[model samples]
Structure formats: structure tokens, C-alpha cells
Target chain A: EAGVAQSPRYKIIEKRQSVAFWCNPISGHATLYWYQQILGQGPKLLIQFQNNGVVDDSQLPKDRFSAERLKGVDSTLKIQPAKLEDSAVYLCASSLGGVRGTSNYGYTFGSGTRLTVV
Target chain B: AQSVSQHNHHVILSEAASLELGCNYSYGGTVNLFWYVQYPGQHLQLLLKYFSGDPLVKGIKGFEAEFIKSKFSFNLRKPSVQWSDTAEYFCAVKAYNTDKLIFGTGTRLQVFP
Candidate 1:
């Protein structure tokens, strides 16, 4: 079984520029998530999706960030007009959600995309 | 709001030494807990978890954690450490019946050979 996969392992952009990151979750997983990990800090949830619908995105910076999981499969997260603070690692994870015995099973994460804003 | 806490920012130990890392959480309702490890340049992987029943839960790679409801603590412990165990460890918490996870700041463990 393959783990979650992410694209463009690294990216660099100027402030105010737009950047997008992609994620492909495990084949049968129903729950997908995106997190932002700033340097020296832990990963913070930016958004979550259950199938094709969003489960939660309260922490997402709506003013500059957006994400979508289309057809209940792969998903994409975009950050426009990036800020210097947006320079951080973006990680994607997936889990077999809501299954009586599997809901508590932890997520499998991607290698993550490291983004830098100058 | 639910939140997780890891008291140690970094820990260094020699191979074959006992290891313990602290984790605490602030949540009013029933919750689930987990410990995840990320080796250098690798993705975060589950080390252990506690859902219900037994307070002590064992996980992959010979790691285990004890959940103490009274103290609101879930601390990771390894009887003996190895160089292979050098990694960053994070404690995460999720409300029971919810999918969202709150994570700790993480503790970097360096096991010296």
C-alpha cells in the first residue's frame, strides 16, 4: 500500500506571489488534511476533508488560502499573495475515516512540500 | 479550545538508555491521544495511541505511552533507546468522536551511539 504523496517537494516565491501545492491520499482513505509547519513549530491544521466535502477549515486563512478535494480523491491547496510568514512546510495526510475500528487509526502523511517566500 | 503540550523541546540520551517524553493536553471532554515520530527527512509516523480502556497503549517500534486522565497527561516511554530512535516526536490530541487533531510543539530526541 502506497502512502500519501505530494508534489513539487520544494518551492520558492516572492511575497504577494501565488503558490499551490498538491496532495494524493491513500487509495481507500476518506479523510484528508493539510497542515502548515512553520520552522521550529509543530504542524498546524489548515484544512480537512472527508471525501469531497470539507470537514473543517476554521484555521485556514480564508483571506489568502483555499483548498479543494474534487471527486473525493486528490486535493490541492493554494496560497495567494503569500506572506513572509507563509514560508513553511505544507504536509498532507489521509486516514480511513469513520470506520468503527479505524477512525482512531492515525493518519499517514506525505513527505511534505517546503515553501519559501522571499 | 483543545490544545496539546510537550514540555521538552529537546532531549539527548545514549544508546540503551531509558527514554521518557512528556505530553499534556487541555480538553474538557473525552479525547484520544497519539505520539508520532519523524526521523530526519521523513514523514511523521504513528508511534502509539490511546483511545479507551487500558490507559497504557503499545505501538510500533517498541514504543508505548501511558494516559493518565487525572493529570491530563500522555507521556511516551521507551525502556531502552537506540540510535535509530533519533527523531522528532510530537504528541497529538483529538476530541472523542471528532477527526480534528491538536498537536504539541514537538520534542527533538537525539540518541547517541
Candidate 2:
């Protein structure tokens, strides 16, 4: 089975610039998520989508960051006016179902996009 | 709020040595625990998970974790580790009632021959 796929494995941008990361999740999975992992830190949830609608995005910084899964199969996360603190790895993951823990399934993550804002 | 903690940041061990990595969480409600491993130049993969029923769960690559509800801890362990086992391991948790996951900072393990 194919796993989640992400692109532009690595990216570099200047502060005040804008950057976007793309992700294609596993087929048939209904739950997609975006996470940010700073160096030496765990992955932090940025947003989640169930089908084509958002399930949770409480941690997402609306002022600078936004994400969307238009057709429910692929997703894109964008950051505008990037800051040095925006340097991190953006990971995309998908699960077979969206219900909390009813199904015994673990998320399959992509290779991730490493962004370095200078 | 839910949070996870991994006590070890980095660890070094020779091949065939035993391994134990400690993890604790702060949520008082029921939780679903998970252990993920990321090899060098690889994506994070599930090592094992504990949903309910059993406190002991075994995962791929000879890895296992024990969940002690009393201590609010779930520690990953392996009787013997190979050099290939060197990787970064993370502990994560999600409240049984929600889909959001809270992850730990992770532990880097280096096994030498």
C-alpha cells in the first residue's frame, strides 16, 4: 500500500516571504492531519480534516498559517510572512477512519517537508 | 489539556544490550497510547499501540511497551537490540474520546556493534 506523500522535501525561504507545503495522503483514508515538528521537539498538531471539512484546527495560527483539503484526498498547508520560528518539518498523516479510537488504526505519515526560514 | 513526556533525550547502548525508555502522561482520563519509531532518513512508523483491554502491547521489530495506569506511564522496552535498532522513538497519547494526539519530545537511541 502507498503511504502519505509530501513534496519539496526541503525548502528555504526568507523571513516575510511565503511558503507552501503539499501532501497526498493514502487512498481510502478519511482522516488527514498536518503537524509541525521543530528541531528536537515532537510533532505538534496544526490541523485535521475529516473528509473535506476540518475536524480540528485549534492550534493553527490563523494569522499566518492555513491549510485545506479540498477533495479530501490531498492537502496543502501554507504560511505567509514566514518568520524564523516557522522553520520546522511539516508532516502529513492519514488514517483509515475519523472516529476517535473506535477503530484500531494508526496514522501513516509522509516523509515531511523541512522548511528553513532565514 | 493532555501532554506526554519522555524522560530520556538520548541513549547509547552496545548491540545485544537491553533497552528501556520511559514515558509519562498528564491526562487523567482514559487514553490510547502509542510508540513510534523513525529510522535515519525515514518517516515515523508505528511501533506499537495500546487501545484498551491489555496493558502490554507488542509491535514490529521486537519492540514492546507496558502501560501502567497507576503510574501514568508507558515505557518501551526490548530484551536485546541490534545496531539497526538505532533510531528516534516517540511516545504519544490521545484521549479516548478525541482524535487529537499529544506527543512526547522523543528519545534518540544509538546502538553500537
Candidate 3:
């Protein structure tokens, strides 16, 4: 099976600039997730989408970070007015199901997009 | 709120040595636990997962994890590790009723041949 796919393996932007990352989940997966992994830290959930509707975004910094999974297959995460602290690896993951039976299928994560804010 | 803890930030071992990485989660409910490993220049991949039955679960590459519900822990273990086992391991947890999968700060393991 094809793994989750992410674009622009690396990106560099100045502070206050805007950047976006794209992701294509595995075929037929219904749940998509976006996570930010800072240096020396675990990957933190930024947002989650069940199909095209959002299931959770409680941890997302709405002011700067936003993500959308349109048509329930591909997702895009955008960071506007990027801050120096926003430099990190943005990871995209997808599971075969939603909240209920997701654990059974587990998640497949992409290689991730490394962003560097200068 | 739920969280995961990996007490070992880094570990160094020689080939043929035993390996153990601690993982603990704080969620007082039915939960799912997982271990993911990322080799150098590679994407994160599942090492193992525990949903139910058999507290001891074995994964690929001779890796296994014991899920101790009483201790709120699922620690990865390997009887003998190879230099190829060097990588960062992450522990994650998801509550039964939630869609969020929280991860703990990864533990970097470096095995020397």
C-alpha cells in the first residue's frame, strides 16, 4: 500500500511570513491528522479531521495555524505570520477509521515537512 | 486531559546488549498504546500496539512491549539489539472515546557495533 504523502520536504520562511504544507493520505483512510514536532519534543496534535469535517482542533493555535481536509482525502496546513518558534517538522498522518475503531488500524505518518522560520 | 511520559531521553548500548525503554501514560480509562520508531532519515513507523488481550505484545524486528495496566505503562524491550536498531522511539496513547493520539517526548537510542 502506498504510504501517506507530503510535499515540499523542506521550507524556509521569514518571521511573519506565510507557509503551507500539503498531505495526501493513504487510499481509503477516513481520518487525517496534523501534528507539530518541535526539536527535543514529542509530536503534538494540531488538528484532526474525520472525512471533511473537523473532529478536533483544541490544541491548534487558531491565530497562526490552520488546517483543512477538503473532500476528505487530502489535507493542507497553513501557518500565517509565522514566528521563529514555529520552526519544526509538520507531520501528517491518517488512519483507516475515525475515533471509534482507529486503534485497530493504527496510523500511518508521512515523512513530514520541515519548516525553518528565519 | 491525557499525557505520555518517556523517562529515558537518550540511551547508548552496544550490539548484543539488552534494551528497555519506558513509556507511561496518564489516562484513567480504557486506552490504546503504541510504540513507533523512526530510523535515521526515515519516517515514523509502528513498532507495536496494544489494544487488548495479552499484556505482552511482540512487534517486528524482535521488539516487544509489555502493557502493565496497573502501572499505566507500556515499555518496549528487546533481548538483543543490533546497531541497526538505533533510532528515536516514541510512545503514544489514545483514550477509548477520543480521537486524539498524544505522544511523549521520544527516546533516542544509539547502538554501537
Candidate 4:
């Protein structure tokens, strides 16, 4: 089975410019997530999608960041007028929805889009 | 609020050496713990997880973690590590009732042959 797929593995943009990352999750997965990983840091949750509806987006910066999971199969995360602090790897992950007996079943992540804002 | 912390930022070791990485979280309520590994040029993958039952959980590639609820710690360990085991490890936690995860700054392991 194919794993989560992300496009534009690397991106370079200037401050104040716009950038977007795309993701295609594993087949049949109902939960999708977007995360930001600054250099030397772990991935931080930015948003989550359950089917076509958003499950959580408490960490998302509403002023500059936006994401959409149009059909529940693919997602796009956008940062308008990016800032230097936005330089990080944008990771996408997916998991089978519903509850795992204990925790939710493990998540499968994409290789990530490395964004460099100059 | 839930937060996770990794004690070590970076570690260097020779191949075949033992490995232990410490992780702790602050949460008054119950929690679920996880350990994830990211090899160079790779995505994060689950190494192991702990929810209930045994405090000790074994995962793939000989990796294991012991979850201590009293101390709010879930430390990953490997008795013998190969150069292939060199990677960045992250510790994460979620509240007992939620699926949202809070992650710590990762620990980078460098294994020299």
C-alpha cells in the first residue's frame, strides 16, 4: 500500500510571499492532519480533518494560515504573506478514523514539504 | 494544558551501544503516550505506544518504552542499537479522552560505526 504523499518536497519563498503545500493521504483514511516542524523540533499540530469537516484547528494562525480538505482525500495548507518564522517542514498525516481500542491507531505521515522563508 | 519535553537534545554513541531517551509530560488527567522515529530524509513513524495495561510496551525494530504514569514519563530504550537506529526521536502525548497529540522537541541520536 502507498503511504501518505506530499507534493513540492521543498519550497523557497520570501517573507510576505504566499506558499502552499499539498497532501494526498492513504486510501480509505478518514482523518487527516497538518503539522509544522521547525528545525530541531518535533512536529506541531496545526489542524485536523475528519472526513470533509475540520476536527481541530486551535493552533492554526487564522490571519495567515488556512487549510482545506475538499473531498476528504486530499488536503492543502496555505500560508499567505509568509513570515520568516514560518520557515519549517510542513508535514501531512492520515489515520483510520474512529477510536482504537486504546488510543487512535497510529498515524502515517508524509515525507513533508520543507519550506524556507527568506 | 498538556505539554511534552525531551530531556536530551542530541546524543552520540558507537554502534551496538545501548540507547535510552527520556520523555516527560505534564498533564493532570490521564494520558496516552507515544514514541516516534524519523530517519534521515524520512517521515515520522510510530516506534511504540502506551495506552493502558502493561506499563512496558515493545515496538518494531527492537524498540521499547516504559510508561510511568505516576511520574508522567515515557522513555524509549534499546539494549543494542545499530547504525541504522540513528534518527530523531519524538515523544508525544494526548489526554485520556482526546485524540489530539502534543509533541516534544525531538532527541537526535547519532550512531557512529
Q: Cα miss at B61, model 3 (Å)?
A: 0.3
Q: What TM-score, over all chains together, does every model reach?
A: 0.96, 0.97, 0.98, 0.95
Model 1 fnat value: 0.59
Q: Candidate 4's residue-wise lDDT over B1-113, tens digit each?
A: 99999999999999989999999999998788899999999999999988789999999999999998788899999999999998999999978777688899999999999
Q: Candidate 1 — which residues are off by over 4 angstroms?
A: A99-102
Predicted candidate 2: what Cα RMSD to the true structure?
Answer: 1.0
Cα RMSDs, all models:
1.5, 1.0, 1.0, 1.5
Model 1: docking quality category = medium
Q: What lDDT tens digits, residue by residue, belong to model 3 across residues A1-118?
A: 9999999899999999999999999999988999999988989999989999998898899998888888999999999989999999999999877556554767999999999999
How are the candidates ranked when ordered by lDDT, highest leading?
A: 1, 2, 3, 4
Q: Clashing residue pairs in candidate 2, if any? A: none
lDDT of 1 by residue, B37-111 (tens): 999998899898888999999999899999999999999999999999999999999888688888999999999
**DockQ winner:** 2
Candidate 2 local distance difference test against the native:
0.93
lDDT value, residue B3 of candidate 2: 94
Clash count list over all predictions: 0, 0, 0, 0
What is the per-candidate TM-score for chain B? 0.98, 0.98, 0.98, 0.98
Error of 4 at A56 (Å): 1.4
- For candidate 2, the TM-score is 0.97
